[model samples]
Target: MSSAGRALAVPAASDIVDAELVNGDETAASGVDVRTARDRHLSAETVAAIEASAAASTRRAYAADREAYLAWCRQEDRTVVPASAETMAEWVRHLTVTPRPRTDRPAGPLTIERAMSAVTTWHLEQGHAKPNMRGARAVLNAYKDRLAEQKDEAARARQATAALPAQIRAMLAGTNRTTLAGRRNAALVLLGFATAARVSELVSLDLADVTGAEHGYDVTLYRKKVRKHTTNAILYGTDPATCPVRALRTYLTALAEAGRHDGPLFVRVDRWDRLAPSLTRHGRTIGDPAGRITAEAAAEVIGRLADAAGLTGDWSGHSLRRGFATAARAAGHDPLEIARTGGWADGSRVLARYMEDVDRVKNSPLVGIGL
Candidate 1:
């Protein structure tokens, strides 16, 4: 039997139910056998899974772009299924000049590229022939070349600022441990510095992912930049003042006092020490209903704390993680050790780049001079 025929030979019951929910009576009304209808639905699902295999954030952006492109096509009276090269090129022009609804700024080169990728993916999913070498892609490449010659990409790009350990310590000191929010932020800053964890990994943490050790805690991160190196070792601070483990314990105690045991390790709260109401119940306070703190919110919290501490310069969610690697390198730890601790893959040049500024001082020949 052919591949398609073999796949259709078996239909799971859940697939049928899902198909029914989606298609209503349309499939049934067509006089097709139930098995055939279910097989077709399952095939569609397989195609969807294939498309969705990309990162969650990428998939979400693609889905949104797909909708936006379709809307634009409808408004322009253009065909979207097999969007001609001309249509694609025209859409690229629109993306370049159009200000995003939220940001009110024209789409950056990266954003435009992602939008184009989404459009092309949609066309591919529809089984349209991809004349990528000759059509919209060619136009995009030429336009990109012109853009490159016109703009200094490096000058326009945002540089990643590495956080210093002292700055993080100052931020932690600025947090008010007396409040639930402060306690959470304290732990968050400490963990970010200690583990050098990406913002997404930090926000995805749950109460169950951490374990108490004699001196510190072991946090098992399920996702990170390196898939296999998810387990990170977090050490307790020598001082009670800035200890991440103690800060985390205090935060958990606050949660327990409020009758929350398991869920997001960090949650949103207002100034009154009241937790953000769970979205599931909508205004009703119910069991462990605190929602996950978003990455943007987490970064905003760090920025506010930094501002309060009177720390100057541009800080970001990546600051603490960068600080960790910077501090570790300055303390005489080797690159391999730093990479392992920061969840960086073996032989990662990115680690070296992060420690560049710090190394300038430590590895300088002036260090041994009699000045």
Candidate 2:
């Protein structure tokens, strides 16, 4: 008649098998049926549904955090059941201030706040009287504010180190295009700057995707990041383009000359006619493994290029993308246009960051000045 009695009546063959697998003959001899160990308060279907709503990455993180939280509760002799508002609040507080054992670092407010939210949601869905998460919400807000401050600080620091587009142009000009590697690097840099592409998008390109037209060639950048609004609109190259379309065209032609087609536009070439793993088995060679290039690889490429060009700084692949956005804004391109080109979902925020940097450099008294 009771819920616990009903749960006990339902057969759980899988649970018994799992118990036998873990404990061998210990569970069978004790006469303790593992099938009856089910959480009578909640159905297995409910738990499964909750997990289905989460993304794969989210699920993994939540699982790890949940295990840690439950283990801690067990160690402290606290109830693992999220059956009351008080219990939920206690858990949220514990997560907020507790130092993680392995890292010995205080759990970041956002990380713990997210874990608490997941737990609260799960508990509430299972008909538990969990807290409303208002406290957790406040902590999350504080965490975001901290992040914003850090971002602002980073933007300022980068502003001081930011290179001008013309400076990048100067560096590009130094590359000796006579050799295959030199030509490839030049093309890579030009495409990276011109498209304002993430290093991943830049590297994932194929020769087939790039086409030459009478006016200029179009390098169809798939999986590009652009403003959601302008996603429907096709953005062509800038007028009076800073870099020539001929440059890209010439590079593609060079690839053809090398007898490479139906593969990555950028191949790893150690010597003449020698190819590297830049090209996948599918006949597509990526500039940076189809945008999954490690930070290390990106750093290596930037460092090598910078060293060769005799330029100084800790430039990385991101610098190329960021530099393009910064330069475009300085050149008087509309912020929305920059966002559309860069595949940003929010244009205003990105524009504001760039405008702030510009103002800093110009010492413009009217920075953030209203129209």
Each prediction's Cα RMSD? 9.0, 12.1
| lDDT tens per residue, model 2, 1-371 | 32222333344444444333455677666776555545445566654644454455576786687677688778767776653445555666666556678876556654766688657644544445555666556655565466567773322233323445665666666666767676676677667766666666777677766766665666666542341221122234463223546457666677778777766776676655344445455686644653233434544565576777788776777667677678877777777777767666674565577667765766676656785
Kindly give the number of clashing pairs for every candidate: 0, 6
Q: What TM-score fits each model?
A: 0.68, 0.56
What lDDT does candidate 1 reach at residue 270?
71
lDDT of 1 by residue, 21-96 (tens): 4546886767566665554544555655554445678868888988899999999999987877788878877876
Model 2 per-residue lDDT at 210: 71
Residue-level lDDT for 368 in candidate 2: 62
| Best candidate according to TM-score | 1
List residue ranges in candidate 2 displaced over 4 A: 1-133, 136-163, 170-176, 224-246, 271-273, 277-299, 307-314, 346-351, 359-371
Candidate 2 least-lDDT 10 residues:
227-236
Structure candidate 1, residue pairs in collision: none
